[model samples]
Target chain A: MGPIMDLTIFGFLVQDGLTTGAVYILLAVSLVMVFTVTRIVLVPQGEFVAFATLTLAGLERGDAPGLAWLLVAAGVLAFVMDLSAARRRGSRRGIAAAAVLFLAVPAVLAAVALYGIGASTPLAAKIAVTCAMVVALGPILYRVAFQPMAAASPLYLLIAAIALHFVLVGAGLYLFGPEGVRTSPLLDGSTEVLSMPVSVQTLLILAASLGLNLALFAFFGFTLQGKALRATAVNRRGAELVGVSADYAGQLTFALAAAIGALSGVLIGPVTTIYYDSGFLLGLKGFVGAIIGGLAAYPAAAVGALLVGLLEAFSSFWASAYKEVIVFTLIVPVLLWRSLAHVAVEEDHD
Target chain B: MNRRNKSACAAVLMGLSCLAAGSAQADITVGVIISATGPAASVGVTQQRTVPLLPKEIGGERVNYIVLDDASDTTTTVKQAKKLISDDKVDVLLGPSLTPNSLALIDQMAETGTPMISLAGSGAIVEPVDDKRRWVFKTPQSDGQMARAIIQHMTSQGIRSVGFISFNDAYGEGWAASFRSLAEQVGIKIVASERYQRTDTSVTGQTLKLISANPDAVFIAASGTPAVLPQATLVERGFRKPIYQTHGVANNDFLRVGGKNVEGTLLPGGPVLVAEQLPDSHPAKAPSLEFIRLYEALPNAGMRSTFAAYLWDASLILKAAVPEALKTAKPGAPAFRAALRDAIEGVKDVVATNGVYSMSASDHLGLDSRSRVMIRIENGGWRLVP
Candidate 1:
């Protein structure tokens, strides 16, 4: 047994829980958004987080980020697919637009990431470039791997998502190597609250999570584009008939997911060490949070993720060896409860 | 009478043809199983890179190395081992970079009557001198040896109680078991012990628990970059006591990832880590420097790793034993493999990168206390703790 639990220890554990929980919350929100829109579980959501951090570290080291080259590769694939699709349509009306979006954008980003950045580059710019490179990967991947299968069942989409997760993990290893990296902290010092030390990085994480969630809330509630996305989520065919392009909504949703994942990487990079495979576990934790909402409600998912963080924190204190087991075991009870509660509304549909 | 004479003639011809076939092929084959692409890639990649640098011609006979990637999976290791032994008919086997994979290989080695030099750092691979482990040997110092060094240093420093944290895996469990048994002999009590996963983002709770115990020192038994988190977390939480880590963090990446937070930490590692700092009279100095020079000459080799040295030492063992084995039997024969195993066992005081190995029937891992060096993290580099 450890020392008797005291208030100071409790305070520190809470702080640790909230900080990690915040990152999971961002992941959960993005997951919910992507799932509702595309009917895909977005299993590789954590790869984006891993890639963003590794790319940022690469930029800081003056090594050309590998994701930039990956972006270019994905762009080339998407471009070829677009050209073939256009040929089938018997008209080249949008050929130029497709070329610019699917080819030129990625090439430009890759060039900037490879040659423009250096160790002397400012931190903010480095983060921006990392996000841009990672964000570019999303829509191109959606175009190449997902859009053609858009009409498939959610089961197949989930399978495809899991496959994509593995590809990204392999690519991550190729880009970042097997070494784990920890970036320089965005905020370096700490302040004491109730005699418990709270790192500035933790504070930064909380603020970023709160701000991103609020922004997302406002986007979904007020903006016309947001409504279109919501419309697509409500009913894909209905939204397509009402002048909301399904392709546009899907791409936009993927871009949002990528952005949230990238931002989470940036915030969490300084707080802990991250490797190419680290995101799978982190993303799985967020998936647990999303499941707590039955994969729908935003607030419930956020609260569930926070609870996971707290439980992980406290459990690690008492039984660090079984922390993961305890955290993952949470989903079984939640699933059972949801199954019982929603039994009446159950209906079999693709 | 005519039928018996005809059968005798046929038997004589078959014996002559077999002798001719054995004499025609004079090359030796050594199969290497490395985890070049998975969780153990850091260790495997280095060992793989060292492959080309091994002796191409041992004892005037050509040596061929067939390297296969196990991807750090135990099942793959067994599959590859079978392929190497049954298909390739390798004379000896090397590596399978992780502990569990190495343990999985003992049965295959024993079944095939092959000698194996494992690069994994656990004593379980070669301990007990059982029928299965007799064919297995390893280059890395056992966790028990490193634990003894750390305990000796603690005793001399007047440290009474210690805190312990390690990864929740085979490697950590091995260290915990070894350290627990060894530390008890010295009357040093463990005030607290905790385990964390390799991919864990934070160890705040573990750190808090360890701090509350108020031990004289904290020892973390983990390897690679994952080992950095607990020390960094402890330092961030304002723990000023000395922290001891296992030899797993001897690589350059650990220093790069840990940065300033790792300063003043101490660990016991192979002599390869502080080769240049050793006294000139030390036996391992010259070979260690030679390994560093050769490894650094490779393009994009980065820093010299202890894991690579393990492979280099394995090569040295082969170079010394091949001639003896060749003297007894022809290459590509079961008799030749049996001879090679015996030759390796009889090897004595052969100088190489990590230490001078002296193998015997009872001991396969032939390094002594001279193989380990006390290291302190200072000024972003390893400093020999005098």
Candidate 2:
């Protein structure tokens, strides 16, 4: 017999959708932020999530995460580039600042990864180390991979991002092995809510998502760096004229994207088993949301992603085999509406 | 002067004899295609690791293996298979490490008249013994054989209805098809059926649907760590019924990933899973223990994998058939390839790590009832279900 539609089932499905949607929201916001600021779609956003989860898993197992070494390597590359650039400019203070950001920070984290984080480490310490290790890579990646081609076309940047995604995925496999991992839940047990069972982990996820989004709103609406990023997104030439360093904006955007991705991973790790390449599909789903927003609107992307999550849940219940098809097919009508609503503009070829 | 002259003469004689033997018997080349780097890497890496452990020389002729990674792509698998057959001219081919890849290679194998020993799980790799599959053989136990074992266990447990969740691909679909037919024979009903992608992050809706149907048990037909998602979700959602899994999750990774969620899961798997637990009288016991000993002795051995055992069995089959093929024709010739295929088909009572293989014209997989045992996950390890 097929499942009968019932209130309990609907509640469970909604809870599931919201939980997954929360993680997708974090990813969608990051995707939009990076896309708007850098003119590059961050295809490797999912890698950050996978790396964070796997890093925590590695810490739980008491093995030093291989990602730390990657951070060190990237740090060295970025440092060299910065040192050379600073030397050409003949700025001693810039050299010192570069040394601090690109060298000292990664070295300290690498040391922590090597010695401090272990099986006996506290959960908070482990998560802190995991996030620091992953988040630091973001700026390093920007400086090393994207800075040189900051003036390149979006399509060219898109190709580089895709290539970067493959590199990270391959590196992830080497670091985490081929097996999937799921962390122990941050909080244990479930309780009744509205006559339905609600997991504490689900509550934590919802709370974290809400808190992070609020923090993001406050940062963007209040902070000078955030306004600079917004200015850079609106027009790089105008932002440069207004004394906003476009380079700093790109680096700051990448840092935020990585932090959001890492947090998403931390929350999602306990809920699902994640593999090295699991990021691509997760990122692709968020991308469907980013597309729904035309890659420019944050609230729209968030809403679109949640809708995608709800549609996924309902379709899985109704036609489990075609859930992916149904979920992805949503973009068709959305793209159609968006294109029809807006008139074509003159080409702004760079 | 006498010592130096005598040593020189002995070295010359040894070199002459080696040359003669080399001219007399050409080295046998066995080409292997594995999905060592992509989605199926969990399965394929173990099989790839077992390659170096395979015999370097079978029947006194040096065996050289040319292993290629398919990266878990079907087109890449076909390309590598063609490269091995036409370029390397391997005497016998082994593995692309997945059902879809193995199925794709059938036409290529048949056209080339090359003998292939697939290491994938699907029985469709060699079923019907048609003109195409006649050249293809596999080492893994068929889905039908394992299905009967599971159905027998369900009957013993007095479970009348079950919920089925499987992957949308061949491995899952093949298991579902076999299990359903067997369940029907025993008058057990499958109350609900669901399919999922391997990479799906959540199965909440599907699990909710299954729970609503309220079967006596849930049967999960999936492989690797992906299989853990459904069982874990079920436990999280308060489904307090028996959960049955197929042999696909017979690896240490699954145990490590599933942890407490997979405790009490019942499955039908190869004898290799519980080698030490098997009674001495069991035909598969000695080979299983021997296989385990060799596997554990490897330099970088981590956890024993059933996928690795399949490759080891493939090697055993190769060792058994190489001498017979040699009797008819020399290595690297078209005749030798045909002879090798015939020899593999004629292999009889070759006890392997999984089971005893007795091949015939009609059956190519060669595994019998002795290959499988009912097992339960107890205290995070496999225990024989009495």
The TM-score each candidate achieves on chain A is 0.97, 0.96
Per-residue lDDT over A1-350 for candidate 2, one digit per residue giving the tens place of the 0 to 100 score = 55688888899999999988888888998999998888999999999999999988888988878988999988999999998887888876667777887899999999999898756778989999999988899999999889889888888999999999999998888888888999878899888889888999999998998899899888888999988999888888888999998788898899999999999999999999999899999999999988898888999999988888888888889899899999899989999999999886432343
**Candidate 1: tens digits of C-alpha lDDT, residues B1-386:** 23234223323422322222234466787778888768788888888778778887888887766677787889988987886777667799989788899999898889889999999888888997689988988888988889999999999999999999999987788888889988999999999989999999989999999999989999999988999999999999889999999998898899999999999989998998899999998889999999999998987788998999998998888888889999999877889999999999889998887888998888999999888989999999999998
Q: Give interface RMSD (Å), model 1.
A: 1.1
lDDT of 2 at A222: 96
lDDT of 1 by residue, A27-144 (tens): 9888999998888899999999999999898888888789988999999998898889888998897779768877998999999998888767899999998999888888888988
Clashing pairs in 2: none
- In order of appearance, the predictions have TM-scores of 0.93, 0.92
Q: Please identify model 1 stretches exceeding 4 Å from their true place.
A: A91-95, A344-350, B1-24, B86-88
User: lDDT of all the models against the reference?
Assistant: 0.87, 0.87
lDDT of 2 by residue, B26-139 (tens): 888787888767777878877777766788788889876767778898998898788778766778999978888999999999999999999988778899899999999999
